[model samples]
Target: MMAGMKFLSGKRSIFKVMGLICKKCALAIMVLALIAPFIATTQIILGDSKSDLEDAKKQQEDVQSKLEETKKYIEDLQGQVSDIQSYISSLDSQMETISSSLYELDLQVQDLEATIKTTEEELAKAEEDAKVQYEQMKLRIKFMYEHNDETYLGMLLNAEDMADLLSKAEYINQLSKYDREMLEKYKATIDYIAQTKADLEADKEELVNMQTNLQDQMSALSLLQSTKMTQLTNLNNTVAAEESYYSRLEAENEALEATTRQLEARIKAEEAAKSSVTSYDGGKFKWPTTSTRITSDYGDTDGRSAPHKGIDIGAVKVGVAGDPIYAAYDGKVVISTYSASAGNYIMIYHGDGLYTRYLHCSSLLVSVGDYVTKGQKIGLMGTTGNSTGVHLHFDVRLNGSYVSPWNYLSK
Candidate 1:
């Protein structure tokens, strides 16, 4: 309360008002006058304090608003990263297909070259045989032309008997028949070789055309692949650059809005989970992973800003990735999606407010609304999102809060 020495205008008015009352009032006035300066100072201090408090509250609100905005921005960036990765995968598939086609084309070209070599060899052999036949026919014709009528007349006059004369004439007729047959055979051979050469040239032309086509296609595919790779690289660079900024903002804003939202979502899921199942008759949950190695226990916050909500199972195998992640218990999947923090995570709702989570998965095998059995493979363990290494982060939420996996898992 603010106190003053005067009611109307001056300290005399305070004394006059008290005089009209009683001696008790006068005593009160005396006390009020003694403490008047202190009360006035206190009024100013109270006003300043209220203003300061309101200012502090406004600053807090502003900080909280900034935190939410920053979180939302980071989430958007994560989504963009996911989209770009999917595009990169698609481009990879296309490039593989192109490479396979190119490989096939290479094989065909090799076969064509082999066939052309064989054709040329066969063509050369036929031409050589035709030339030999031509030379033999020329010699025979020249010998017949030199002898001519003299040889035939000599054969007739020198004959001792009519039987010998007839035999000589028959021999001359047989020589004429041989000459005619050789000429016809040479003509046929020339025609067949000419046709074969023409066909071989056509095949060679076709092979050349095919190779030209393949080269053009390869050039186009190469250009497209180059463009796609550039896009992928740019996207990767953007993610790498923004991640640092995101971390800076995340460190400054201590609202933990993202964490709160996750908890809220789990809380909302509980109602739906309970409605779906009245109770869980299943005994102990199966181990969520093959590895029995526990890396991080629940509620442990060392090396991180926030407490760990689940158990992290390290890879105890030869490889880091592709380890099978199984369902802890039989339940219907309530949430199956990717997140900036959780990466590929799954939430399975068992009856009576019991839910399970698998985080940092390389791949998810089940979708929302799908029911899975205990020990069923749900995903492959991986180091995704905000993970440190290859591991399965298994979580159990009973009644909207994270619980210990040891309590649910069997020995």
Candidate 2:
């Protein structure tokens, strides 16, 4: 009975040691999974962490692009405002020139009026003199016709000498011709003065019309210039506001990065507190379940040729649909979704900005925000979103970029 008891005690001791070894092994494997993404060149397992990091990176990139585009838009708006301001300045110059021209036109009109008045006065005097001379000549010609025999003609005829008769006849003819020519000359001068007055009136009317048209054009230009100035001011204000907003966003992003670093340090300290285990030593790692070989390697070369971010582990024969999918390590469940390309997907945010992704699951066993333990069931592997058959799409992410998971796997 004592020997039997001794054998039983030995068996019990061995079992305890084996249990200890298994626990340690699992812990070490988890540690490697957490650290390998950063420290080593490794392929990633399709998991939640990888998806979270990738999504964050994509979001950051999109925001950066938007920021740049906004800057360019602001610059364009500024340029447009500048152009408007320049146009306003040009309008101001044009207005000044127009005002000056209008002033000159006013002076020209005044001078023309003065000249017209002077010309009219001179013409009126000339017309008065012509009329007086014409009346006097008519009176003289009529009187001569009525009294010619009793006047100079009669006297000249009365002279008996031949020389006197000839001189008297020539003198009468000269007087008669002088009276007729004076009447014609006075009429012609009066007609010329009337025509000059008409021309001055026409010139005054034309000058007034030209000045009115110019004033109308200047008024329109002034309105346009004022409108452009207002638009420019508004645009400048908009650009300033946008620039300030972008500045704030940049500051916020920096703060977020700092916070992320601190969290990673805390996670690292917590991980160190766990006791050491045998599984930490390099060896063939037991598959989380009896599963088929991987059908798609990490960073697969075919199709799209962009670096494959994860591996595809096929479920050939071991499990039925809706079977439990276990967590490879302890981590927080950060995201879960039925994504088009990933099917039912989950992203786990681990420490140090490391992340993992799991996809193509039939159903999720754990909700987002759940704290999972190592080997905890998180989902059921099955063909789901963007999947061809029953399999698991797994990934690893570091600082929001996809990395190889193979480097972290213990097997």
Q: Which tens-of-lDDT digit does each residue in 149-228 have in candidate 1? A: 88789989999999999999998788778767766776676677567657766775776676566556556545544654
Residue-pair clashes per candidate, as listed? 0, 32
Write down the TM-score of every candidate.
Answer: 0.41, 0.50
How would you encode candidate 2's per-residue C-alpha lDDT over 130-209 as one tens digit per residue? 78887887887798889967887676869789888888888778877877777677677767767877887788788888
Give candidate 1's error at residue 232 in angstroms. 2.7
lDDT of 2 at 241: 64
- Model 1 residue 300 CA deviation (Å) reads 54
Per-candidate alpha-carbon RMSD to the true structure = 35.6, 26.2
lDDT of each: 0.66, 0.63
Best by lDDT: 1
